[model samples]
Target: MDTTSDRSRQWQWPQWILRAAAIYNLVWGTWVILFPHHLFDWTGVARLNHPGIWQAVGMIVGVYGIGYWIASSNVLRHWPIVLVGFLGKIFGPIGFLGAALRGELPWSWGATILTNDLIWWLPFAAILYGVFKIHSDPASRIPSVTRGSLEQAADAILPRPQSSNGKSIDSLSRDQPILLVFIRHAGCTFCRETLAVLATRLNEIRGLGLEPVVVHMSSLEEGERLLLSHGLHDTTHISDPGCVLYRHYQLERGTVSQLFGPAVWWKGFQAAILRGHGVGRLSGDGFQLGGAAIVDQGRTVQVFPAANATTSLPIASELRTTLQCAAPIPKAL
Candidate 1:
């Protein structure tokens, strides 16, 4: 795991690369604009009938240079700029090849292509890869820890995972075993599906004597707002932003197959598109998996790790873990 500072450092290379690219493009554009036929003469090609057309192309490249300069500040945030530029770089060479083969352009012009387009391919691809990694895998935002440290932290938190209301899981579950429901990033479609299920089956869960305590990796206010939106105002909420409880419960970071497998995609489509449990923006660690457990006296009596991001815990009646729970919270105002 990495921290915010580390992630910030990881993005530095892309920023610098983009900045250099911006300067290079601006200088190249200006050079082409000022002496449109200079490169044609160097490349041993006759001047165009209207050199203004080439200057117009130079103008367009200059505009792209401005976009790259803007994008350099936040490479990940301005992925579209990189994406378009990358495409242009790829296609520009192809166009050059076609012209060179048809005798409209000299092979010597490929020298310009190498500098203008070929040189940027790797760094541009790396920037795009960084963007994809940062978005899909948020583990970089989490603090680093060893297995021993994680075990110690989890040991301390699992029995006493602090709640928004200042009560500990151990204290709250002393009598009525709390159904500790762990969910992934708040934006996940399965998270929405699970919350909707809990909200719809709140009465059913309480009827079975399990006071559902939803543990999430978000702020107290954010957890409350998301839960309240799902009509789960009465359910208890635990804000575990560090995922100590998650590590304690053995819900490790999901694998690629578990998180983005074909099955998960289909299920996500079903929940988001068909069921209308729309996804939201990322709230916390996107890599963490979700699970459920019945905690009695802060000790896990029954555990149910989710099979994948798409398959959530059957929280209400289907939980094989028979909970010896009672006394649900009073209705929210």
Candidate 2:
């Protein structure tokens, strides 16, 4: 792929747009972190029993501000970050509307939504549109002169990445079959649900002779923190900020219907609000889809690619049923 640096010079407004967003997020997050209950008081909502939980949410937003600041240098190359932020901005208000209708929250709460989410919609959308046009243009597309196949993927063009705990996938699964679970950015509620689900089913998964190896697109440090909260920080995880492994496995970027469809909205609400897997800001590639595979000896046995953002992560029984027809597993651990 050609370097986006030269192409990035073609655009100017996106840089400023992203920088402004970064500054706004940083200041807003700082304020919320320092006074977690201030926003609620201003909005006429009762104080929370757990202000620390709200403070943590502010921390997540503050982290996103850092990501936005890094991305401002090359908006075109960092379009995924922008996309995630845009989606969050779009959906944040909708979530607010749902609360207002249920009478659990007051309309006064919208003031923060205006600054934190609504105001950024158009500029963010414009930046995304500009990205779309660039990607749509033939000249802007990276030449396919190089081979980016799976064979080469296992042997990376750059050095292959290791799991968060300093182990390699080949080393971990060299002897036995492992469940390769590729998840979305750490911020996605579905991603959190996937991790939480896997945490509960760890023993059951090993019972099926498959150890879990998670793949994500967040920095190793952020991945560590996210997984630690779910008690899976010790689980094998690979940090692929560039998503090279994702493309190698043929996981493509999702479309509008795949990501933001009506069904997705309903499932998101249920998973986020009802299921208690609350969402977060963009911590990685927002457009990238996720999947799972059973691998032993460098090849996939059965692939379970997610059809959409909210597709349920397969459970232990589901894996057992699916692996029934596949190769026999060794009983010994």
Candidate 3:
């Protein structure tokens, strides 16, 4: 019979396998990056219509290779990078399925997506899950706080402190509803557009007796600049660089990359064409996108969970409607 220690030792094999997979990713990614055109030619795919395109592809593949190499070293912080890679793999196949359904791509494309995306998808997920499990466990604590709990704690730990601006969360009217819009860091175009929209409709939200709190991961100065750039100086702005609020509110989830490896370029092209822009690039390469959650009275009442990178959350109107009928907002004061 195997002893407990022996079983524990047996469990170590998965980590070794994960390391091997990481090495494989690094090698394959490097080949693709260094010989992109040659790889495409050998695969019978046309050289990208533009020379710069191939260069960009090479650079991206090279970076991905570096990421895999880092992840293989068993660095705890790099797990998110590994998760993004897994998402890329998964999204690639799903895109193929969509293409096949629309009769836009051949069955071979679907096959390619399957082999590239689904292959090792499960194992990668298991690896991530195992890592998170260990990290969450007190013995192996990774210093993570759960989303639901964190949000509640934020309400208590970081009470709306009064500042020069008299518009703190504490000062807001108790009878009115509040919209806490969490914006991404400066690099996110979607967040910028979303902020613009909010700015345009700031009065409309105010007309509905709703206060809008613009939350972002930046310095107070940066947050103020973002608001000013968007013509939203009057909006309440807060900065939380540690993503403590994001994690506490459970809005920090992002898709993995293995799900996206196959179809990313194509989707980028589609987006570019749709927007009438010659250059098409998927935002953040189908990973590293944030999520949204709505809460009231310290309870999560609504969550617009993302199925994948391509899926869009409901717009402001829809989100508002959903929140309207949600459980009553808590009166923390």
Maximum-TM-score candidate:
1
Candidate 2 C-alpha lDDT tens digits along 108-161 = 888888999988999988788768756633234333333444334335443345
Clashes of 3: 26
Better of 1 and 3 by TM-score: 1
Q: Write the per-residue lDDT of candidate 1 for residues 270-331, one digit (tens) a residue.
A: 99999999989988878788988777666677777888897676645555335533333322
Ranking by TM-score: 1, 2, 3
Q: What TM-score fits each model?
A: 0.59, 0.56, 0.47
Error of 1 at 5 (Å): 9.8
lDDT of each: 0.78, 0.78, 0.55
Which residue ranges in model 3 land beyond 4 Å of their true spot?
1-14, 18-73, 77-175, 257-320, 329-333
Q: How would you encode candidate 3's per-residue C-alpha lDDT over 1-333 as one tens digit per residue?
A: 212233234356445655666565556556655666765565555676765665665466456657766665553455787788788887777776897788765565555455445776877787776666444322222112322454454554433322225554444434355566665455455556557677777777666555667666656776787789879877777665545545545553443442254464455445445543233122221223444554444445555544433333346686668666766433322
**Model 2: colliding residue pairs:** none
Let me know the TM-score candidate 2 reaches against the reference structure. Answer: 0.56
Candidate 1 ranges with C-alpha deviation above 4 Å: 1-147, 151-162, 315-318, 321-333
